[model samples]
Target: MPKALETLVAAGLMSSLIFPVYAQVKAPILPGTGQSVQYDTEGKPLTASESSLYTGQDASFEATPLRYQDNGDGTITDLNTGLMWQKSHDTTKRNLTDSIAVVEAMTLGGHDDWRLPTIKELYSLADFDGELMKPKSGKESKPYIDTDYFDFEYDRRRPFAGAFWSSTVYIKGDVQNFTQHGGLQGGFGFNFADGHIKSYETGKFFDGTTIQKSDNMFVPGNYVRAVRNTTTLYDMDYVDNKDGTVTDQSTGLMWSKSDSGKRMNWVEALEYAETATLAGHSDWRLPNAKELQSLVDYEKVDFPAIDTTFFEVTPSQFESQQDSYYFWTNTTQGDFKHTAVYVTFAQAWSKKNSDATEYFDWHGAGAQRSDPKSGSPSDYELASEMASDYISIDNWVRLVRDAK
Candidate 1:
C-alpha cells in the first residue's frame, strides 16, 4: 500500500484527493517564520486597536522651542542647544557655573530627557561645515544655533549682544598634546584656525612654553576644556598598603606616593616594580609623579601629608635605600644638573634635589658631581644595581600600576 494511502486509511478520515488538496494549501505559520503574512513596509506593525491611539490629535499642532533641524536619522536637534553645544566645544576646562546654567536652561524646556552631554556627545559636535567653522542656521538647517539661548540682563550697564556662551570650556591652544601620557606628543586632528574637524590629528599644536624642563610644572592657567566623563570606570581594585604606601591591585603599582625628600631614580624604581611578582602581576611601572603626589593629604601630615589608610610606609622608608624613606620619580627636570627628582613623605616638600645629589654632575651625563656644601669631588655608586647610565643620581622611585 502507498504510504499516503495507508496513513489516510488508518486514520479513517480523508480521501487521497483530500490529502493532496490539503498539501496544496500551505500551513499557517507563526510570526517571524519564513512564510509571508500581512505587513505594511512604510508603517509600523500594529493591531486595529493599537492603530487608533493617535486618531484624535489636532492637525494644527506646531512644534515648540522655536526651531528644529532634522538629524537625518529620523530625529531632530534643537538650534538653541546647538549654539550652547558649540560654546562648550570652544571650552577646555570644565566650568561648573557655565555647565550648570546650560543644564538649568535645558531643564526648563518640555524635554525632560535633556541631561548634561557626555564627552563623546561634545566630541561629536566638533568639525562643523568644513574649514573648522560651525554649522550655521540657514536654509540648510545648517547646524542651527539660536541667539536667545542666554540671558544677558546683567549686561544692561554694558552693551547687549546676541551671542550666547556654551557650557563646555574651550582650550584655545592645541590642547590635545596635554592629554598624552609619558610623552607630550600626538593629538586628534582638528582645524586650528576655525575650530573645525579635519583628520584624526588635524590641528596638532603644542605650547612648548607651558612645559618647564627646569621644574616639572605644567602651566595650570593654559585654557583646558573639561569634558564630562560618560563611561564609568569599573573593575578597578585599590591596593590597601595599610601603612602610607598604596599599590594598584591590577598593575601592582604604588597607586600614589608622597615625596617629602628622597634620592631614588625613577627608571630603577620602575624596573624594580616591573620585576615584582605581587599577586601574580609583573607589569608595574612608575606612576606619573602626579599620580604619586595625589596621595598626599595636605590637611593632615605628621611628617608627610598623606592618606594613612591607603598607604604602607614608615619613617625608616625614607632613612636609607635598604630602609629608605626617599622615593624616586620618573619625572625629569630641565635643570643644568644631571640630577633627577624624587618625592619623600619624610619631610613633605616638593624639592629640587634628592638625597644623593652630591654624586651627579651639574650638566654632564656621567655620574660625577661637585659638592655644593663641601666643594669636594665624590664617586657615588648606586645603592641598587637597577640603574642605567641614563639614570640620575639620588633618584628614588615608587611603583605604579595602571588603574584597572
Candidate 2:
C-alpha cells in the first residue's frame, strides 16, 4: 500500500475503527483551479510577508496542476480529467434543446461521441488568472478560461455573453428569469467572461407577437463546447476518520469534518483555515474554487447540498429566514480584488426586487458565485447588476489537506 494510505489506515485504526472501514475507490481526478498567483484581501498581489500572514490561501498548497494538450486537430485534451474538448465553440448561441442537438450532430476530431459536459467538467476549464474587466472601462476584459489552449471571445454588444451550457439542470428551476421565459425550467452554465456558474432558462422564448425558434430569436442563449469520453458521473467516496476529519478515497483529500461554525470575512476565513490544526495534521489550507466546489453534493437539493453523513453543516439565520451559508474559496474574483469566489451549498437566495421584503432561491443549490471579501454584507453594492439585492460578505470556512 502507498504511504498515504498506510498513514490514513493507521490514523483510522487509532481513532477507534468506524463502520465502513477506509477503502480506496477510483474516481475522476479534479483539475486544479489554475490559480498560481496569491492575492491579499484587497485583491492586490500579495507580498511575501502578506502571503505568510495569510498562510493557508489557495496558492500556498498545490493539487494536481492543470495540464491540457491541444491536438493538431480541433480538439484539446485535459490530461487531468482525461476528457477531450472542442478547441473552439460554435459562435451561434442556442437554447438547451438546440445545444443538445448540436452535440448530437457534431462529428468533431473525426469522432461522433461528442456531448455536453456536466457543470463540474466544464468548470475544470476555468482559470482564475484571468481578470474580469469592468464593463465600459475601455479595457478588454480577460476571460476566466485559458484563451491560448481554447478559442474564446467576448460579445462586444453584450459584455458578459460567455456562458457555456452544461448537461446538469439547476434543480430549483429558473426563478431569476434569465431568459425571455420567466420562472421556467433552467440548466446550469458557466460564464467565463465574468467567472460564475448560473442557471439559464432552457425553454424557448416568445416574442411580443409569437413564439420564435432559438435560431431566429434574440432571447438569451448559451454557447456550446462539446466534450468526449465523459464516462464517469459525479461521485464522492468519503470515509469517516472519526478523529474530526474525513477522507475522500476518490480524490485522496482529507477534510475537516465540521466547518468553522461561524461567519467571517474572506481574510479571516483564510487565516482560520491556514492556522488550523486538526486530526493530528497541520498542513490544512483553504481549498481553491475548484477544490471547494468538488465537495458540493448536487444530489441534495435541500439545505446543505452536501453529504451531511461525513460533514457537519449549519444554516445561518437572516431576518428569521434560515438559509444555507456561502462558504469562501481562496480564489479571488478574476475581475476585481474586492470579491472572492464562494459556493452556495444550499439555496442561493435573492430578493424579489430592490424594494421587495421576501427572498427566494434565485440560483439553485450548488451554484457558484462571488462575494465581497470584506466589510458588512450591507456595506458593499451588489457584486453585479444581474445579482440579487441580497449579498453575504461574511461566509463560512472548511479546511482541506492532501492525505499523507
Candidate 3:
C-alpha cells in the first residue's frame, strides 16, 4: 500500500478494504464539466464522426453528470458536491479581505453560515458549454457557468472583470521573480467569461493601461458567490488498486497511476488516451477540465503540486530543468478552439518582454491555463515576447475513467 493510503487507514479515516468505496469516506465528489457538446479544432461544433476523429475529447467519456437544484429562496444546491451556493452574486465586487467579511454577515435563504468557497468548490459550478464570443462578432457571449440556475453578469467596459473570487490565496514564496506592477498579493479566481482560472491581485487594479492600488472599498475587487457545505468536508480519498491504477473514492473516478511520461500536442494526447489500456481496463479517456483539476493538491507548496504517493508525475527531461510539466485536459478554451485548457503541476513559467533569457513563475503552480491545441513548443518562443503569455504548448497526459 502507498504510504498516503496507509496513513489514512491508520488514522481511521478510511478502511483498508476497498469493497464499499463510497461508504467509507466523506469527501466531496467533484462534478463533471457539464460539457456534453464537442467542438473541432476550428471552434466549430462537430458531429459524431468528427467527435470520433478526436477520440478522447471530453464528450467522448462519461462522468458524474452535473445536476443542480434551485431552492426557490435565492440558493442553488449542487447535487453532485452537496454544496449550496448563492444563486446570484452581489454586483459590487470586494477584495479578498472584504469578501470574507461580507459572507460572514450574509443571511440569504435564512442561512447565516454562508462562507467564501475554496477554489475547488467554486470551480465545481463551471460549465464548459458556454462560449466566449469574439468582440464585435455580432453574437452574444455566454458565461462558462449555467445561467439558468444562477445569475451572472459581466462589465461591458471591463472584459476580465467577470472573474469570481475564491478563498484560496496564492502561496507567496512559490513565485520566482514575479514582478507585475503593484505586485501579486492575490487570491485565485475562476473567470466564467473566458473559461480559465487565474490569480488576480487583491491590492491593486490594472485600469487598462496603469496599475493603481485600491483605496476605496471596491474598485479593484472580484465578484464573490458564497457556498456552504452540507456535510463535513474531507480531503481527497485516494485508494491504490495495486493494478497500475488509482481510485479516487471522493470523485468516484479511477486514474492511471502514472502519466504518459512525455509531452504531446493536444490531438496527440487525446488519441493517446483513447487507445490507452491499463490495469485490465480499456475505457480510459482524457479527463475534462474540472475532472483533471480535482487532482491538483493545492495544499502542496512545491513543484508538482499534487500528491505523489499514488500517482507518478514525470519530471522534465530537458537538461537542468528540475520541475514537472503541465498536463492536458479534454476541455477546449471557449474563446479559441485552437487552444485547450491545461493545468500546471510545475511552475507556470513566463519570460520578460525585454529579456527572453529570464523566466519566472508568473501564474504559480496548479493554475488552469490554455495553450495552442497543436503547435511546436518552439512556435511559442516568439509569442513569449509578451510577458503575459505562458510558455508551454505541448503537455503531458494522465488518463481517467468512471469508477465502477
TM-score on alpha carbons, each prediction? 0.28, 0.84, 0.82
The C-alpha lDDT values of all candidates are: 0.29, 0.75, 0.74
The TM-score that candidate 2 achieves is 0.84
Q: Model 3 over residues 159-223: C-alpha lDDT tens digits?
A: 64588998887763333353554345546888888787766665543222233444332346789
Can you give the lDDT of residue 254 in candidate 2? 88
Which residue pairs clash in candidate 2? 132-334, 132-335
Best-to-worst TM-score order: 2, 3, 1
RMSD of each: 25.8, 10.4, 10.7
Who is ahead in lDDT, 1 or 3?
A: 3
TM-score of 3: 0.82
Question: Cα lDDT of model 2 overall?
Answer: 0.75
| Model 1, span 296-389: residue lDDT tens | 3323424333455555444543322233233443322211122323433332211123333322111111011111111111443334331112
Clashes of 3: 0
Can you give the lDDT of residue 16 in candidate 2? 41
Q: Give the C-alpha miss distance for residue 211 in model 3, angstroms.
A: 13
